[model samples]
Target: MTRRYCSLPRQSVPAFTPGLAAERLGALIGGRRMWVNGTVLHYCFLEADTDASVIPVPGTGETRRVPWAGAREQLDVVRECFREWQDLGIGVTFAEVSDRCEAELRIGFQLGDGSWSEVGRDALSVGAGERTMNLGWDLTEPGGRWTALHEIGHALGMRHEHQSPFAGVHWDDEAVYADLAGPPNHWSRDRTDASVLRKLDPAEANGSVWDPQSVMQFPFGPGLILEPEQYHNGLYPPGSLSPADKEFVLRWYPPADVPAPLVPFRSAPLGLGPGEQADFTVAPLETRVYRVGTFGESDCVVVVFEERGGEPRYLAGHDDGGTPHNTGLRVRLVKGRRYFVRVRLHSTWGSGETAVMCW
Candidate 1:
């Protein structure tokens, strides 16, 4: 399918209702905490008495200091925020790492200017297995607290909340684009501003339809300065979370599943070189546990193939129980070598763990 993109501006406050519900469900499923697989976070500490508004950027390899009280307060709030997710089954926690921190699972913090933007340069450097959140020195200042939360969301690997699928309901694409374009980062591309809209995983498409009220969502614009109608419920700030957004986060990434593994178990290839042909088979560890068939009649297996890079190519296979209990597939590989395969065991309950194989 062709990738669909949406044009929307980022919001300051992310929607929270959907996330709340997802947390509830996760707790019921497995007693284990949901893990956020990839992320590396860092924070800068400041003194409580220091002026956060005029904070200066920290020099490289230097730790800007924050008032003991201020740092403690911010950390407390942050800890509490993550605790909420943890309670829901998401496994979000904090750790202390110095410069030795690496990408796999390392994060560090430094105290410096929050307004200068540059001070938090690597603040968004989260990768697989690591995520980062920043605590600006001026967080105690008015509006600064919200900024800290917004940045933290990013540190948690969430794109602007406004990018939620439901954003199309409230956003006036042309108007918002006119205002957001022509900056250090132009919001021209449909996918540029709306990170939530992007397809991070195929499951998201099947799960909740779409929601705009997720706490991970961004507001129409900063609280003031730009009072777009979407910001409020026709006339006032619409504070309630959207059903879809709330359901999405809460259901997908519950607090109990903090540090959850967000890896793609099953993946299709992008492109394959011309005249190339590949075939493979996988046997279920326990065959009797899973029966394959449309409606309990005959046994069968399903195979799916897709081209990744050059052009979109796909195929599927169904094998009768006669063939050594294994299903096979063959495809004509195209130039550019971008292709992958995925296998599914369709049963009465539901599909699980799409076994992915590539060549």
Candidate 2:
């Protein structure tokens, strides 16, 4: 069979507006619509300040229940994406299993419109009827296929490529605001800032360099970018995953390696207060990005260290990340080394809880 490439127009393409979809699902500036544990959590609120009034759930609120018939067709596409991940050694699986079976993640359309998936392991937080992924729209073409792969990328713990702090793409902010606020996406200033202008922190930087052609990246169209001749006109249609996409999956989800923890090392719901810190130890393992985040309203700072002779040696530290200032760090730990993780409160808030995770 011949392949159909994603040919979303440079402007006014609704299907290409995944960020807008996320905004519609109640993800405010710097706040995640979905939460991460060892799996994705959909139809559930993770942060304290999240607005629950608009969340779509069956027989609740004013939103329509998911049309499972349509959802099943989309599941076929999701399975294809899963197969690709499995082929690349990422140990994730997607299928229509019995509701009684204990599964890591459950995806459906019990939420707001468009295609969206919780980042990585946040999916484990929902109930059977609730969805960890939503296909508010239908999957009818090759673009649907690309959408499936892009969302599954999130399911695999990868973030938006354009948000990479190192991408360095000079966005024409005013033009971006103007363009996105009209036509298909009538995003507000805060949503625009969070979705388009917000850059991932240096600590969240993964892979070697930015992959503009990555499926996780949204094409900016003409006049949206102002730097790097390679990106001034926006990227060509991301019909499929770039080489780096595959490499990232293989590197993070090596089949031979033991699976990382399914749950967080700690769940600090109240958060660390002023001058407060928490410590944890890591086992011997190759270097990879470990995430530390506030489930509540506190800003967080994380420091990684190696214990030596009744002392501590610093290895890595990060303050803000994602659009919300969550923290992430990539570090290498020795097998028997006792590592101390110091989680500190960075906001004026008195106290906030945190969750530390590795995968």
Candidate whose lDDT is highest: 2
Candidate 2, residues 1-359: lDDT per residue as tens digits?
22222211111111222343332222222222121111211122111222122435557556632343344566667677667756665423333334422334455443234456666534444454444555545565646777777776776666777778888888889988887777455567776776568786553444559887787777667777898776777665565888898877654443332222223354534333432344455554544445544454444556665666544444666655323446677766665566656554434332434565543
Q: Deviation in angstroms for 208 in model 2?
A: 3.3
Worst 10 residues of 1 by lDDT: 31-40
Give the poorly placed runs of model 1, Cα more than 4 Å off: 1-73, 91-137, 142-152, 155-157, 177-207, 221-250, 253-359
Cα lDDT tens digits for candidate 1, 21-73:
34322221211111221111233332234322323445765454443334456
Reference-based TM-score of each model: 0.37, 0.53
Candidate 2 residues lying further than 4 Å off, grouped into runs, are 1-72, 92-96, 110-112, 126-129, 257-359
lDDT of 1 at 29: 23
- Give the 10-residue window scoring lowest on summed lDDT in candidate 2: 5-14
